[model samples]
Target chain A: MKIHNFNAGPSVLPKEVVKKSAQSIINFNGSGLSLLEISHRSIDFLEIIEKATFLIKRIMNLNDDYAILFLQGGATLQFSMVPYNLMNQEASYLDTGFWAHNAIKEAKKFGKVKVLFSGKNKNYTYISTNYHIPCDMDYFHCTSNNTIVGTQMKIFPRTSIPIVCDMSSDIFSRKLDFCQFGLIYASAQKNVSSAGMTIVIVKKNILGTIRKNIPSYMDYKIHIQNNSILNTPNVFSIYTSMLTLKWIENQGGLSFLEKNNQKKAKLLYDEIDQNNLFENKIHQENRSNMNVTFFLKEKNLEKEFNKMWKKENIVGLDGHRYLGGYRASIYNALPLESVQFLIEIMKEFERKFS
Target chain B: MKIHNFNAGPSVLPKEVVKKSAQSIINFNGSGLSLLEISHRSIDFLEIIEKATFLIKRIMNLNDDYAILFLQGGATLQFSMVPYNLMNQEASYLDTGFWAHNAIKEAKKFGKVKVLFSGKNKNYTYISTNYHIPCDMDYFHCTSNNTIVGTQMKIFPRTSIPIVCDMSSDIFSRKLDFCQFGLIYASAQKNVSSAGMTIVIVKKNILGTIRKNIPSYMDYKIHIQNNSILNTPNVFSIYTSMLTLKWIENQGGLSFLEKNNQKKAKLLYDEIDQNNLFENKIHQENRSNMNVTFFLKEKNLEKEFNKMWKKENIVGLDGHRYLGGYRASIYNALPLESVQFLIEIMKEFERKFS
Candidate 1:
């Protein structure tokens, strides 16, 4: 049976990407050496990173003002990096869920972080647009999508201050105006690429304002100056990301992916509302298109329902440890058929048990 | 011609490791999901990491006092993290080569750094072991191997302070007591795995001493507590490292590889010493077994020598830009035949030119 992968981040990637990356590992571009063996500064890898950064800007419609950096340490490192590079006086943050709060926790170590709003009052069930952005703050920080609670910001707060976003979960799966944010960082384990690399797209002017001796690894300016080759980078990760970006571009960019994602989300969320056996707790409008989280109405059905999905060859359908519900992360590469297949299983479970 | 890869690193991995890792990228352990697509928290990956860590301790014979952490951001990140976590007031460092100097530079930012001795007076051609490490310092930092100038420290200075060594190039290629150092960090692209992952084997007690709110990513204690899954790690790189380590064990562990490495080094260095057209400036005792550096007696022969090697399908023979000549990085995976193959090409070139 073919496995239907609904894993969260480091989740499903394109089949073609899988095949191509696999081939490269054995003999990279007919170089007679494995991709694991070539120098990062080689002409082959230099072109790969260069093309990968070029594709990121082209797909996102980002201008030259934005410096694209392929960094390591995941988005967790960015929680500290964002404040270290931008927060001189203080920064304002909107705590959406676990990761956003994690970012806030790290930002506190660097300087003052005023949480403009938090979703904790309601079990983080909805994305609040009610928070007012303080104009005097250094930067307005927020997570574009919260994977844990399945809440996504439908609209970002308008502010004169530069907007910094951690879009680790739902970056390439949606469309947004490119100029609305000053900084954006996403872990490659999501819809972007394999694990081990982080993409940091920042407007060049917003950096160098903070009065701190930021370490070279944390400094945005240093990475930009070095073209992300300040040190030995994750060459294989960057190459894998390049293949993924090429796949995304070939499928007609964000406009096409946005439509594909919306269709998938609609199919899964509709099944949740119609099926009495399963219930979704997240607010309807704030529901994430990338991840659909729903729980079985009768908690005792957990074993049977899990067995049903496993027997049907579905994997990674379990929700995050933070929330005790089922989550199907329909990323950019997750086929619409996977969602349809999952719905069929949900219906089958209802037919037998309900 | 079959290429003989001599790239410093992201250098050659074992052929078996390359093939197996490539297969995993397509269908990880017959799970029908690409290794790149699986969650780091999944049972398969957790087992992979657990086994990888277990094998590391077994191969090195390190006791429970050491915590083996699979991290990202390479050795450069460790430059900052080592000081951020261990250097309470000050640290003493031996300035040996480019990367060693980089560690000292980053350490100076975190705490007072005293460079006990620098090889820059003689152009980093030798490793100096005569430097006095201050016992008052929190740690004494040094690099076990220098890939840039091709020098290796055959003996580590005995110090009362914690010894933190950056063994990026020659780790796992030789056997050592391992208990002599408080911390040892190595980039996986060298004698370990692919790029994007760093192996940090640190003593458990030496950490938690620095009086600072260390960032989660930088804190060794946090990583140990979380079992190196503190955040989303480079799952692919870790898996590849596991494969490489397993390959090492199957090759009769470090003792066998040490003999193999010495044989390769002996063959190449003997050829370099005997060749009338070539010369090596490094102190004989400090020469690296991992990377052997040699220069042409006639600088005008550069083009002809480059042509000869390229024609023979020898890649990455070019030396570091900092100190230009030639470098043959005979890492653990590089076969004795490849080194012999390089010697044949060198003799062929000499027959035509010398």
Candidate 2:
């Protein structure tokens, strides 16, 4: 059975990346050693990390001032690390959904945190654009994409305070002006690599101002100065990410990904609107191209809809625990053909019920 | 060439484990989804994590009182997490080697750390057993095996003050009384899985006593309550570890491993003793069965020795950067034939030079 994977974060990966990574696990670069067993300090691994770092800088159009780090723990760790390293007195945060709220929660432990905007009252179905960016804030934080609610920030708010964005789901899936943000972090499972690594791109000049004695692993200055090899890193995750980036680069980088992403989102969103049986919860303007969420208009049809998708070998189409319905996370690796197939199923589902 | 891998941590994995892991990466258990692409929340992954947890307890003879957590960020993060979670005001640490020194350095940020003994003066050739355990201290920390200097603690000191040990290098290689320690942590790269994962075994009752607000990801109590699914874990690393543990369980568990480990260590140590070309660095009683450190009697023979080993397809025989000597890390995965092959090469080099 051809499985259509759509689980949010730790989601689908490029087929080529999967194949190459598997081969490397058996024998890494013909070195007669499993990728799972090779030293991170070896020449082969050093090249892999260097290439992965270089590709991120090149694809994102980031300059030399930015340092690319492949660290362990997901975006959750970054929630504390961002505040621990950057926030000395106060920080501003935009709470869009679950992950953003968690980030805000972590930041509160470090120093004072001011919430600029929150979409929680609206069930996170929309993005908030009308909010004041506090000038006195140490940094402004926001999640670029809300995975659970299926809302995405279409345009980043212009702020004088150094901007820190958690682009976990949307990174490398769109074109953006990289210079505007001082620090950007993304967990690898979404559009990048496997589930264990987090990629941090930080502007070097913004660090070291804080007086707190940061833990060595969480310290950005130490990781940057040591070239991300301060300790034995998650080598498999980093190497898998390198293969994923190679795929992204080959497919014309973010520009190509953005176009395909738009096409996929439109195919599914247009069907949801046309069909009477289904309705998207998120506002059209704020709809995420990565995670397209919708629910059946008739609640009783949920069981039948789930059975139909499962029969078709579709995985991870169910919604999150907090929000019940359906969330089809169409990451960069998910093909347009799969999206079209899903649309066909949706239309058939509506025809039988309506 | 069939390469003889002897790299320290992120070292050799059992052939069966590597093969199975690679297959899983392609299509996990006929699910038509790559292990890399499967959601961590899926039933497939949850079962894997549960089984891995269960086996660790069963093999280590740990009860429900101990919390087994498979976390990300290697042992480097544990150096801080150990103190951040357990230490209230003061802790005692044994300065065994490079990693031990690093642990002490990270502990200083959390509390007043007292060094009971340091092996630095003796080039970390021996573990200190002469120190008294401070009654007032919160915990006593030590490294069971030093990879760099090739020393292993023959017997752990009987300490009442919550004993904390970093068993990264020699974990699961032999049978030991697992109940003697309050907390035990090991980096997965050594005798476990890949580099990005860490295994933490802590006593459940000891936590929540510290009033300090530990960052959620670093807090053991929260992680335990959440069943180590606090965030998106390194799925690949965890899965790989499970496969390795399965292999260990299949091979008659730790008792079988202990005999094989001793045999490999004795074979290499015998060669080093008999051959005048090479000399073992550590004291005879303190030598690590996991990592055997040695030096060439004549420094000029280093280049020839390197060439000879390279020709035989031996990898990771080079010493750590800080110390210039050879370190043969024969982990559980390495077959006895590979060590014998290395010994053959060592004898040949001596014959050619002598």
Candidate 3:
């Protein structure tokens, strides 16, 4: 049975990326050594670092001004690190969803964090409209996409303050403006390869601004100086991400990926809107092009529907424990056919129950 | 040509471990998703965590009194964390080499670190003697293996106080008296799998004694409370380590691994000792069975010998930049055949250059 994966964040990956990564693990470049066992400082492994870094720049249109680092500890760590590094005085944060709320909580420990706006009043079902970027704040922080609620900031708010983004869920799904942000970090799981490596793209000028005594691993300046080999990196995960970047490039870069993502989201969203038995909760204008969340006409049918989907090998459809319905995360690498098949399944369910 | 990997830390791994790990990354146990891309909270992944934790206890012969944790940020992070969690007052340390020194430095940031003894008088060429552990110290800290200097503590020092060991290089390479040590940690690159995961074996009772407001990530109590899933862990590395653990079990457990390691080390050490062309600098009694550091008889011939070894596909023989010469790290995955091959190459070099 060909199962369709719709896992949110540590989600689906391209088949070629998985195959290439697997081969490298067994025998990397005919060296008769597992990638898992090669030193990160070795010339062979350093080449991987170089190639991965180069591909990241080429794909994202980043320049020499920005340094790419592969660090451990997920985006959750970065939420604190971003504030620890950049927030000496105050930082303006837009609270959109659960992740943003968590980021704000971490930032508060470092210094004063000015809440520019929040969507919590609507139960985080929408992105906030009001914006008040604090002039004295060190940086304005925001999550590019809200994974839990299926809402994305289609266009970023204009701000003069140095911008730092926690793009953990929506990093490579679309082309990002690299020059605008001082620092951008993404936990590599969604749209990237796996769960282990966190990619930090930082502007070289913004390295040593933190006032407090920063730990070597947490400090961007130390990492830039050491070339991300300050310690033994997550080697296998970084290598797999390199393979994924290659796959993304082969699929015609972000421009092509954006179109594919739009198509996948459209197929599922259209089905949800047209069917009387289904309803997508998010406002249509701000709906995520990656994750499409919908619910059955009656809450009673939810458990049975989830069970049927599980039997059919349609995995990860049961929504987050907090959301409590259904969500199909159609990230990059989820083929259009998979989404179509899911829509067909929905139609079959509607016919049987509607 | 098959290469002999002698890279310190991320050195070599069994072919079977790599193959199995690669398979899991592509589709873990018929889950139809890459192990690299799965939520840590997923039932499949939870089983992976449970099994890995269980197997560590089985392999180490640990009793129920110890709690095992898989953490991020490497041994360097643990250098600071150990003290942050345990060093409420004074801590005793044996300054053996670079790693021990780094640990002392981090510990100094929190409280007074009493240097019980140091091999710095001999440039850390040997393990310390004439140790005096302070009774008032909270705990005694020591690094079991020094990767850079190629020296190891043959036996752990007996102590009334709690003992903490950074067993990064020689962990699982030999039999460990788990009951003697209060806590033992190893960054997974050396003898386990790849980098990114740090395995901490902590005695259950010693956790709550520390009186400090440690950050959530740095706090051992929080990790113990959350079952090491305080946040999303390095899932792929943990999964790979599980594969390595299973491989270790299959090869007749730790006893078999100890014997195999001893045999491999003896082969290389014999060649170094018998041949006039090579000389191991460390004190023989304190010499590491893992990293065998040696230099050529003629300084000029070192370059020629390195080139010759490279031609034989022996990679990562070049020692740490801080400690010049060559280092052959014969970790568990390094077959005895590779050591014999290296010996043959050395003899050939001796015939031509000696």
Candidate 4:
């Protein structure tokens, strides 16, 4: 039976990409050598990284002003790197979820990080409406979508300050004005590729502005100068991302993926709101299409609900450790049928108990 | 036709490791899910990482005083991280090769870096045998094997200060007194895994000595606390390393592999010394078993030699761009038959041209 995978990060990937990646691992381009064994400087791999960088830029409609780099370490590394390279004296960040809070924490180490707004008061059930961005700050940082709590920032704050967004969870799944941000980074595990590499798209002008001497690996300017080959990169992850980004391009780019994601999210969320046994706690407008958080109305029936999903082969539905409900992450690779199957389980539980 | 592969670092892996790794990528232990899709926090990955850490410590005969960690950004990142975490007022470094010079360069940014010795006068053809490591320095750093010019430090200096070794190119290829070092790091691409992940073995007591505020990712103490999962690690690279390490264990551990490596090195080095067309420039005692760098005695025969190797379906024969000739990297995974094949080509070229 096909497992209805909902696990966030290192999560579902396109089947075609997985198959092709496996084939490459065994015999890369019929070279009689596994991709794992080839040199990154080899023409085969050089073409891969080049195409990966090219695909992402074209897929996102990014212009020549941007530099696309695939670097090791996840988005967490970028938390420190962003501030190390760009933060001069002060920066602004929104505390939306667990990861966003971490970005704020790491940034504070380099300089002052002003929390523009936080959703912590209501158990992170909504995104803040009113916020102020100090223009004097070096940059404004925000999480585009909160994976842990299933909240997203739909309307970005309009300001002259360079907006640095952490789009780890919802990048490439929706259409947005990417030009509005100075820097954007996403851990490939979420929606891009595997779990080893992070993709960064940065405006060239925003780099090298900090006075502090940045470590070479964390310095964006150095990486851009080296064309992202400053060191040995995560070859598998970058190749996987290239395959995935090509898949997106084939499916008509972000606009089509965004529409498919919406369809899946609506099917799951509608069942959560209408079913008597379930409750969708996150505010309707701020709810994330990438991750849908729902809970059992009656706490005592948790065991029954769990049994139903297990029998239906639903996986990764358990919420984050910090949040103990259920979260169905409907990422770009998750098919609509999986969401439909999950709704069937939710409906059956409602009928049996309600 | 079987290719006699000899590319250094990201060169070749055990065939079994590549096969199993590729299978896991597709189905992942019959879980009906690709390994690329499973969460890093899942039980499967957690077990893989734990076993990997255990195997390395046992293989190296490390006591509880050592901490094993798998990190990203390769050994180049370690160039900066070592100084960031351990350097106090000053440290000593030996400049042996292209990479060693880079390590010294990065360390200078953190504190005063004293050059204990250098091989620059000989075109990095030999390791400096005499070096005074001051006890006052926080640590003495050296490269165990220089991949660029095929020089290996057969003997290390005795010192009271912490000894840090960058064993990137020749880790686990020979038996050594691993307990003598304060820290040992190897980028997995060379002798361990695919790429992106670097293996770090550090003595526990040496940490927390630097009073500087280290970045979380760069700090060894933080990675130790997190059990090498400080962030989403290079899952593919880690998994591949685990398989290769397991292969090493099944082949009777490092002692057996060390003897086999010596046999292969002796066979090839003897042929190089006897062959009239080729030259081995590195000092005899400093010649590396892992990477054998050779040059054409008669420069005009370079075209014939290149043609001969290409005809045999051999790849990755070119040496580092800085040193133009050939570098045959005979890692543990490379069969002795490949060496024999390469020797056959050299003998044929000499018979034809000389």
State each model's CA lDDT, in order: 0.91, 0.92, 0.85, 0.90
lDDT of 4 by residue, A1-354 (tens): 598899988899999999999999888899888888888888888999889888887888899899999998788789999989888899998888888888888887787889988887888788886988889989999999999999988899998989999999999998898999999999899798888789999999988767887778888998999988888898888888999999999988999999999899888888988998889888999989999998888889999888888877788999888888899999999999999888888888888899
**Candidate 4, after superposition: displacement of residue A349 in Å?**
1.0
The candidate, 3 or 4, that scores higher on lDDT is 4
Error of 3 at A275 (Å): 1.9
Q: Per-residue CA lDDT of candidate 2, range A237-312, in tens?
A: 8998999999999999999999999999998999999999999988778999999999899999988899898899
Give stretches of model 2 more than 4 Å off. Answer: none
TM-score of 1: 0.99
Clashing pairs in 3: none
Residue B99 local lDDT, model 3: 84
What interface RMSD, in Å and to 1 decimal, does model 4 have?
A: 1.1
Q: Write the per-residue lDDT of candidate 1 for residues A1-354, one digit (tens) a residue.
A: 588999997899999988999999988898788888899999999999989989999999988999999999999999999988998888999988999999999999988989999988898898778878879999999998898888899898889999999999998888899789999999999898899999999999998887787888989999999999999898888998899999999999999999999999999999999998999999988999988899988999999999999988899999999888899999999998999999999998889999
Tens-digit lDDT track of model 4 for B103-165: 998898899999988899889888877877879999999999999899998999899989999
**Any residue pairs clashing in model 4, and if so which?**
none
lDDT of 2 by residue, B1-354 (tens): 688998987899998888999999999999889999888888999999999999999999999999999998888899999999989999999999999999999999998999999988988888768899888999999999998989999899897788899999999999999999999999999899988889999988778889998899999998998988898998988998899888999999999999999999999999999998999978788889999989999999899999989888898999998998899999999999999999999999989996
Candidate 2 chain B — worst ten consecutive residues by lDDT sum?
A: B120-129
Q: TM-score per candidate, in order?
A: 0.99, 0.99, 0.96, 0.98
Q: Where in model 1 is the C-alpha error above 4 Å?
A: none
Q: Which DockQ-derived CAPRI band holds candidate 4? A: medium
